[model samples]
Target chain A: AQTVTQSQPEMSVQEAETVTLSCTYDTSESDYYLFWYKQPPSRQMILVIRQEAYKQQNATENRFSVNFQKAAKSFSLKISDSQLGDAAMYFCALVVGGSRLTFGEGTQLTVNP
Target chain B: SAVISQKPSRDICQRGTSLTIQCQVDSQVTMMFWYRQQPGQSLTLIATANQGSEATYESGFVIDKFPISRPNLTFSTLTVSNMSPEDSSIYLCSVEAGGGETQYFGPGTRLLVL
Candidate 1:
């Protein structure tokens, strides 16, 4: 069974500081996709970033980027220059071409001013 | 990215009743999915609504419990039947866009079964 694990249940950072959220997954399939989704208090989930396992280069979107280490089965998300709006529940997800998203227990992020 | 909208942003329903949530996408899409999110929890894929055929349900979710309908590419509905307190959760619909690897989600329908 493929499983996504987010070790940090809660994370806090200053408004302009950097925060890294760790994520690891167990999957037998070599070709897969990893994602980071942000669910704010509004409960609407937004796509933060995506990583393709075949691509060695990590995925970056604005201040959000992923450190995808396929060999280590690790895909961690780094938020740089974090803003107050970044405070939300961050969920790491995995998909193996079937389109079904397997999500991990989210890490609640708190941005302190 | 697709602009998706769901009807009845939030609702309070009585137990034993059923509520059908509608999801409409701005553009045509081949793949649409239904998911359930418990309070303060992660999303769980309930089923994949296939066009013109029966929906493919995930393990632990049944067709009878979560009957889905995808009549066309831009529209789908998910019905929660015989609702109980345990069924109180946020139901979300998402569509695969771009390369089919990325999915854009709807705002979700919040349901409270009492």
Candidate 2:
């Protein structure tokens, strides 16, 4: 069994600033994938970024990035130059091979202008 | 990213009734899945919609409760039968593109069983 944990239930960041959402998981599989998904007020889940466990380098997608520490079982998402659109519920997920995904509780991000 | 859409964006149904949510993708996909997201909770996979075969349900979920239909590669549906207040949640469908590990999701159907 796999479990994902998001310690922070809510997070706030000033406009144009940065915010980091913490996530940790427990999995015995050595090869797996980590993902960050965003669900806005529209209730549509969107993929923010993804990181492969085998790769040591972090995954960066424009304003979003991930710090994947395999040894610590930590995968945190960092949003840089945050805007109002970045305000949403972010989820951290883990998937091994072609299996189903296990998701975290989610962190609700609020960007203040 | 694949574009996905779900019908009946939100519905309020009476207890003991049923609701069917439709999921459609823009292109042909290899794998389709249904998930449930309760209020203030994370997403839990309900079943894997396999084309030309019965859906593979997850533990604690049965086909009798969540009857799934996958007639093709780009479309699927999930019906919630004998609904109750406990079944009030958002139902989302996702698809994996061409055997890819990543999955894209639909907008989700919000069901309020009253």
TM-scores for candidates 1 onward, in order: 0.98, 0.97
Q: Candidate 1, which segments miss by more than 4 Å at Cα?
A: none
**How close to the true structure is residue B101 of candidate 1, measured as C-alpha lDDT?**
84
State the lDDT of candidate 2 residue by residue for B1-114, as single tens digits.
789999999999999999999999999887899999999889999999889888999999999999999999999999999999999999999998633388899999999999
Checking candidate 2 for backbone clashes, the offending pairs are: none
List model 2 lDDT by residue over A1-42, tens digit each: 889999999999999999999999999999998999999988
Q: Which prediction has the highest DockQ against the true structure?
A: 2
lDDT of 1 by residue, A1-113 (tens): 78999999999999999999999999999899898999999999899998889999999999999999999999999999999999999999999987588999999999999
Query: Which interface RMSD values do the candidates have, in the order shown?
Result: 1.1, 1.0
Runs of candidate 2 with Cα error greater than 4 angstroms are B98-100
Please report how far candidate 1 places residue A65 from its true position, in Å: 1.2
Q: Which ten residues in a row have the lowest lDDT in candidate 2 chain A?
A: A41-50
